[model samples]
Target chain A: MNTILRYIFLNLFVRLIVNIILGVNVRNRDRLPEVGPAIIIANHNSHLDAMVLITILKQKAMKIVRPVAAMDYFLKNPLLSWFSQKIIRIIPLRRDVKFVKEDMFSDCYDSLKKNEILIFFPEGSRGEPEKISVFKSGISRISEKFPNVPIIPVFMHGLGKALPKGEAILVPFFCDVFVGNSFQWTGDRGSFMDMLGTRMAALEQEGSYL
Target chain B: MPFNIIVCLMGLFVMLSIASTVVFVLKKIKPQKDYKELSHRVKSWWIMIIIFSLAMILSKKVSILFFGFLSFLALKEYLSMIPTRRADHRVLFWAYLSILIQYYWVYSGWYGMFLIFIPLYVFLLLPLRMVLIGQTQGFLNAAGTLHWGLMTTVYSISHVSFFLVMPKIGGLVAGNGGWVLYLVFLTQFNDVAQYITGKTFGKHKIIPKVSPNKTYEGFFGGVIVTCVLAYLIAPILTPLSPIHSIIAGLIISTAGFIGDVVISALKRDLGLKDSGAMLPGHGGILDRIDSLTYTAPLFFHFVRYLYY
Candidate 1:
């Protein structure tokens, strides 16, 4: 029953916010895996990023998509926690440096073990609008354990201008989503991070051509 | 809403259906050459036609609101394409708000306010808002591009909706709907005519830098075809005489070509192809209606001077 309601809520949110208010143009949509144990990584800029990523997935696939979000931001209060975890199904990660490093990715690992798709923003948090910040090595550490899981790099433009961090009002803008080919972990953490950054940069360049 | 207007729209539907059928048969016959783009264009045409017809067929309020929404979309596209300073973000909001007021004037039949809202009022107000932000760097470019975008996308396109509130002139067969039908039909017809003629008999490049595909053969051929059709259909759809209709056709064709090239110039300047991917094969709303931006305002004033 909760699953059905989540689908309905998400579909409504996507239709009203993503599709109607801000038109989205997606390229190479077929590159995304149909079902997963996969990671969909994208640039962080707006709060709308996670919802926009969910909007592009198939209905059945949406059931298994879990976005990795900061626990402090999403699970701040009871109401927000319920809305985030129950409604949106986000996997809240503890961002505090004092937290135990070994157990940090337990939830992400469990979700992947269950054959779910997890979305990651290696930039850690939203930065300046339309700018890509240096990626954190947290994603590399997590992917090292699941070497076979395909990591898809998606570069989104214009959403930051639509609703950037610290802004409540949404200015409608035409957004472009460019999905790059999926790649497995390259075993080395440093090389894997570089590959992900280059892949996203390439997708961003591809969007500029048209 | 008029019976004759409905008949004319039905005729348009028939023509579109025939075109779709022809494309389908050609795709099957020549399976090697890519018909994917052409087929997508035809499919989008059907969707556009349905939406346009429904908006016109609905009451005046819906039609006005619909066109206002279109202006909003065009403005959004324009803003996304151009690079603007961070200082102009609030100014951009006001620019969008101006669309509401402009369309309200159309709904209320206040022609004077509608005429000056964007060109005179919003034109002055935007720079003031930007000035308040106190960022002089790239100020001129931001102000100029933002205002110009509002002019082309919002102010120019709003004239189409004004046709709804236009007083019904005597001897008008299809009322305001026919007036709109006449203007839109001729404008789009001119575009298609030019493309087809240019593809078939085009040899001389009219302007290679701005638009590579435009040719002298296409321009003359489109003008001839549109003028002839305008002469034939003017009396049935509008109150224009044979001579006046021919003149309208000439104005629309030339103006349409100018609009197309102007946008092409913009795309070249921005180092991009097509504006956005709003429409599948057509590129964007701006891409599909680029010609209408020129034709709508010109045709509106032309008819207003002669009739209203």
Candidate 2:
């Protein structure tokens, strides 16, 4: 009950303030899967990008959708750890896999088994804002195990300029988050990731996402 | 503050209420695309009017800030739509700074400084800023787009508030807000008149390449109706005599029409259907006030030349 209330408060109020300040323009919101599990992948730029993706989702979808963020960063402090665990519903992943825990992958699989959606920034970390780094293979590597978990590529623009990685103050500027169509994993990681990258970049050149 | 001008404003409110009711009824009856658009516009207008009137009623300072805030939004939309190269990032910062400086010039009523701030100083600073940045790629395009955005949004919009501070020109209420209301009412009413006339009697397209829906029929109908509306309202709302009111009406209608088309040209070049999605039916702040951009400067200087 508390989590539901917190989700509603964050989505309705907290996100509203951020979205307003950022002037977040989320297009193709209906492209989100209404029910069941899917991995939402986007080009990471600023910390705000993950929050933007979560804010853009429908309340119904947001309930089941979990953003896959870095454990070291989000769990660094007790407050962030508590908020990520309780309110925002973040799934932290261990980036340093020298001590790989099988439980991390299984936890994601278990979330999917519960028919919950997972949001992943395939770029792995926040790259230079406004520049889409070549996507890492974390998403594709995880997707191989669940072939049917569709991948939705979302392209975000103007976020780096709005609130860059190190900037403390947010300059209220236009930010467009364009949600592309879903693609089923074809078991070929390289080609699928290439196709995803192309589709995401194309939104910047055209007005179709708007 | 006068009884007659207050009545005139009340009449406008009544007319808007009637229009909103009609659109609401139409939506209930059939909910067609056109009616939906009209209803959305009506709803937005109510919000715009309420906020504008509140600011105006509060004081001249609030009204100036209100218009400044509007220009700020319009500038944001303009800057966002264009591709201001990263090299011009600092130059763009200077350009955005013009919003504050120019609006302050208007609010402070620094007539001499406001006249040359953007056109002269900002123009000089823009190229110099880019040169210092040392990035030569698309230099001309970047500078030109930023200059044009400032010229149209900030310089043109400041003229609206210049009406507020203009020295008394023997009229009903001087420049307290009479002329400001007159200019806005005419230009905006011209827009609605043209759209309605075009939809009803449009046959021959007027420069369909620039704006497809503008028609010869709409063009004439809007001018004639807006002229009459201006003639009736100008005396109560502005200092213009019967003859000058007629002239002001004609100037506003024709100029407003051109302004709307000019923005249409810009958007067409940008390959955008609308400037932005800020307003549901209206498109963007820039779209909403395109006519005002032309009418405000033209009327401000016209009034200033003769009176201020």
Best-performing candidate as measured by DockQ: 1
**Winning model by lDDT:** 1
TM-score of each: 0.97, 0.83
Instruction: Itemize residue pairs with steric clashes in candidate 1.
Output: none
For model 2, residues A111-151, the per-residue Cα lDDT tens digits are 88889888888778786777777787767667887888888
Which DockQ-derived CAPRI band holds candidate 1?
Answer: medium
Query: What TM-score does candidate 2 get on C-alpha atoms?
Result: 0.83
The DockQ-derived docking category for candidate 2 is acceptable
Query: Ten-residue segment with the worst summed lDDT in candidate 1 chain A?
Result: A97-106
lDDT over C-alpha atoms for residue B67 of model 2: 88
Interface C-alpha root-mean-square deviation of candidate 1: 1.5
- Give each candidate's interface RMSD in Å: 1.5, 2.9
For candidate 1, write residues B145-176 as lDDT tens digits.
99889999999999988998988779788888
